[model samples]
Target: MRDFSQDIDWLSINTATIRKQHGQEVALNTLLDQCASAGIRAVSPWRDQVAAVGLNSIAAQIRAHGMALSGYCRGGFFPAADAAGLRAALDDNRRAIDEAKILDAPCLVMVVGALPGALDGQAHYHDIARARQEVLDGLAASLEYAREVGMPLAIEPLHPMQAADRACINTLEHALDMCDALDPDATGALGVALDVYHVWWDPKLQQQIVRAGAKRLLAYHVCDWLTPTRDLLLDRGMMGDGVVELKKIRQWVEAAGFRGYSEVEIFSERNWWQCSGEQTLQVCKQRHQTVV
Candidate 1:
């Protein structure tokens, strides 16, 4: 494995990690500048954040800083209430792909959606199998466009806890299955974004990483999973603060030929978000070197 202890050249902030500073939402431009000042080389910003700051402007700013994107924030929410909704989701994903291209992102991270209205606490249906099928179908359509645009799509399998709402593809194996089914040739255009916070508990994680190899392992996200958890969605720990074995996982990933950024993606509303962005980023850089 590469020695991250030497420098943060391999470190990339997901932007969401420091989106909120001291309880206030910081602008994407401000966050970008801060990241540049911190000597961070890369970032992965969300579509909504890019939209707020304007696509052209953000693209220009990234170039000015000589920065690169580890991956794009998102472009998957395929499950919907009806045909019209599914079509709308596809349209949105296409636009996201274009935006990701504009930003020169390495890949567009996908958090394939589950029961249409589940995130809002009112699921449209209780059938999970149907949702998975929708996700498969949605990915097929999106991949067609992604290939045409020469942009890769990285499907991020959320933890099972998020299967009901955030993503139905809850395991790395399942994500790779979808990749194989869609891109049978193991083309670089379709792959998985492995996040430690989501897959650390899986018994077959190492085996699956070998299965994914280099071509299918498109992106990697890191964040410790906290114990005595407060909010399942918002509570996330920094590296070394939780039970995850960060170094071991990275070893497996590197063995699979994944040479990419260790993007920090934390959604800590009550902890890190309450601190200044500077403090949170400093901690992220420090912990990444020592523990991650």
Candidate 2:
């Protein structure tokens, strides 16, 4: 594994990690400036955040800062209630691919949706198998466009807890299965974005990481899983603050030939979000060096 102790050359901050400061949304431009000031060479900003600030302007700012994107925030959520909804999802993803290309991101991370309207407290369908199938079809369609545009798609498998509303693909194995079915050649066009917060508890994590190898492992996200958790979606712990075996997993990832940024992607609603962006970023840097 590469040593992060000396410098943060390989560290990338996902904007969501510090998107909120003192429980308020910080502008993407301000966040970019803060990242550059902190000597963070890269970031992964969400589509909505980028859209809120305007795409071309943000691209210019990123260039001025000389920053790189580890991956794009997302381009999935393919499952929907109807045919038109599915098509809209595909259209949205195509736009996301274009945005990712504009930002020069390495890959567009995917959080494939599940159970349609489940997130809104009323599921349109309860058939998970149907959702998984829709995800596969949607991904296959999206992959065609991604290939045409020369942008890689990294499917981020949410933890199983998120399967009902966020992502139907809940395991690294399942993500890779889709990759194999779609890309088949490990061509780097289709892959997986492995997030420690989501996959740390899996018993087959190391084995699956090995199975993913380097080609399929397009991006890696780091954050701890809080014990006695409060919110499933927002209560992610900072590195070393929880029980994830950070180094060991990195070792496995590196051994399998993944040499990418260790992107810090925390969604701490009550803790880190309550702090200033500067403090949250400083802690991210420190924890990344010492523990991660």
Candidate 3:
């Protein structure tokens, strides 16, 4: 494993980690400048953020800072209420791919949606299997365009606790299975964005990482999971503050040939978000060196 303790050259901050700092939504350009000033060599910006600050402008800013994107923050949400909705989702994903191309992102990260309206307090359907099937179909269609554009798609399997709304594909194994089924040849265009906060609890995580190897492991996200969790969606811990074995998991990922950024992607509304973005990033840098 690479020695992060000495220098965090591979550290990348997923802008979401510090999006809401000091209880406010920090602007994308501001966040970008902060990340560069903090010596972060890479970032993963959400699509909405890029849209807010025009794609061309953000692309220019990223180039000015000489920073690279670990991955683009999102292009999946395939399951929908109807055919029209599914088509709409695919269209949006294509636009996302174009934007990712503009930003020169390494891959477009996917957060496959489940149950359509589940996140909004109600679900369009209760069948998890159907949602998974929809995701497979969606990826199949999107992968074709993604390949033509030479853009890679990285599916991010959210924690099972978020299965109802965030993502139906919750296991690394399941993500890879879909990858193999859709891409078949282990092409670089399809893979998974392995987030530790989601899969750290899986007993088979190490084995699954090995199975993914380098081709299927398109991106690697890092964040600790808090105990006595209050909000399942917003309560995330910074590294070392939670129970996740950060170093151990990184060892497994690296052993499997994943040589990429350890992108910090936390969604801590009550904790880190309440602090200054600078402070949160400083902690991210410190913990990344010592624990992650």
Candidate 4:
């Protein structure tokens, strides 16, 4: 593995890690400025953050500061209730690919949707196998367009708790299985975004990392899982503060021929978000070196 203990040069901040402070949302432009001022060279931002501030302007800011995007946070929600909904989802994903190209992101990360309306408390379908198949159909269609656009699609397999709402493919093995089937030739057009927070608890973790190798491992995300995780949606621990075995996971990732930034992607509403962005980022650097 790379010697992160020496420096945090490869530490990229997923902007959501510090987008909220004291329970209030921070503006995207200000967030960019904060990252720049701290000498942080890269970030990954959500589509909503870009839309809230206007894409062209943020694109300008990224160029102005010579900043880089590790990946784009999110371009999927493929499973829908009907044909019209599915078509709309595909159309939106096309737009997201355009946005990722605009921002010069390395890959467009996808949190493939599940159970239709599960996030809104009512699941249109409770059959996870059906949801999984739909995700495949959606991805196959999206991958064709993504290849034409020259943007790699990174499937982010969310935590199993979110299998009903965020992502149906909840393991690196499962994500890689999907990739292998969709892009049988391993064409580099599709892959998985491996987040330690999501896959750390799996028994097959290291084996799957080895299976992903380099081509299928598109992006890497870092965040600790708190012992008593309060909220499944937001309560995330900073590196070194929890029992994720972060360094061990990094070792597996590196052994698989992957080399990239370990982008910190914490969403700690009850803890870190109560602090200033500067402090949060400073801690991110410290943790990236020592723990991750």
Candidate 5:
């Protein structure tokens, strides 16, 4: 119920939203500078971008510019074809957790992988339930390290359509179930990253948000879903341009005590990505104010 119309003080940009501006990869440093200049306070940088720019250097830049991270993107993809692969993933996730702590991110978002190799049009395993189990096991291992390091893990439930490839955890309820199962004590080390683009269509959304409350809601992501969609992966809509009930969901979230950044996390390859980063950001601000 807070007013975003006056200023985008609560707005944060997920760097991937503008990773490719006008068909070119936007440098993380340049993007950080742009967000700061645009009065955007926080960001959530992907690991690849951070790795490309050197973790220490990016951490220094973030500190120098006084920027905040809404969350780290990301540290999950637990499913694998073999035990060695699983061990490697666990090792990589531990490193990711260390990196997240180094950058002082509030939480590291988890995009729990499904079906092993389905992302590349070939699946190593077709068992969705098994994938979910792997994610839970991986999270349990990661959580132990996270508690020691004082970092939080956020499980972001991808949309149902992406269940086969991106994430098997595709509902707020499902994500919350994992949190409850793992961190039953309501520990702050584990929670869910609620993205409207993914769970906006779920009938149980409001109830789940209330169930999540403040402690289990680690991050809030926003991006409208385009109707008559083009690419399933891309073609995300700007906040006001699509059918997503942005304000209604935010109210549920805020009422549940989640007073955090409404991070814009669109993956628009056809529309926004084809436009200048400046224009895309300007629209993000306007939409954040008027619609979100």
Candidate 6:
């Protein structure tokens, strides 16, 4: 594994980690400035945040700050209740690809959606197999456009707990399978974004990472998983505060040939979000060197 004790050259912050300061949304431009001032060389910003600040404006700000994107916020949620909905999802993803291109992101991380309306406490369909198929089809179509545009797509296999609403592709194995099926040669156009919080508990993680290898491992997100979590979606712990074996996993990832930025992507509602952005960022830097 690479030594991070000396400098944080390989570290990147997902803006969502500090997108909220004192429970308020921080503007994308402000977030970029904060990251630059903190010596963070890269980030991953969400589409909504970028849209709120205007795509061109945020791209200019990123350039001004000399910051690169580890990946774009997302371009998934393919499963839907009807044909019209599926078409709409694809259209939205194409636009997302365009936005990612404007931002010059390394890849567009996809959080493939599960049953439609599940996030609203009602699922349009309970057949998870159907949802997975839809994800596969959507990815196939999206990959065609992504390849043409030279934008890589990183399918993020969200945790199983989020399978009902967020993503049904809940394992690294499954994500890699999709990659193999869609981009048989591992051409770098389609791959997986491995997030520690989501996959830390998987028994097959190391083997799967080896299977993914360097070519298919496009993006890596890091955040500790809180024990006795308050909320499934928001209560993420900062590095070292929770039980995730950060170094061990990174060792596996690095051994498998992943050399990209270790992107910190925590979504804490009760803890880090309540603190100042500066504090959260400082802790991120400290944790990056000492623990991550």
Per-residue alpha-carbon lDDT of model 3 for 38-88, expressed as tens digits?
999999999999899889999999999999999999999999999999999
Of the pair 2 and 6, which is ahead by lDDT?
2
- Write the residue-wise lDDT of candidate 4 on 126-148 in tens digits: 99998898899999999999999
In lDDT terms, which candidate is top?
1
Give the residue spans of candidate 5 off by over 4 A.
none
List ranges where model 2 is wrong by over 4 Å. Answer: none
Candidates' lDDT values, in order? 0.96, 0.95, 0.93, 0.92, 0.93, 0.94
What is the C-alpha lDDT profile of model 2 across 24-129, one tens digit per residue?
A: 9999999999999999999999999999999999999999999999999899999999999999999999999999999999999999999999999999999999
Instruction: List the candidate 1 regions with Cα displacement exceeding 4 Å.
Output: none
Between candidates 1 and 5, which one is better according to TM-score?
1
Worst 10 residues of 2 by lDDT: 223-232
**Residue 165 of model 4, lDDT score:** 90
- Model 2 error, position 78 (Å): 0.7
lDDT of 1 by residue, 1-292 (tens): 9999989999999999999999999999999999999999999999999999999999999999999999998999999999999999999999999999999999999999999999999999999999999999999999999999999999999999999999999999999999999999998999999999999999999999999999999899999988877887899999889999999999999999999999999999999999998999999999989999
lDDT per residue for candidate 5 within 67-172, as digits (tens), equals: 9999999999999999998999899999999999999999999998888989999999898889999999999999999999999999999999999998999999
Clashing pairs in 5: none
lDDT of 1 at 43: 96
By lDDT, the better pick of 2 and 5 is: 2
Using lDDT as the measure, what is the rank order of every candidate, best first? 1, 2, 6, 3, 5, 4
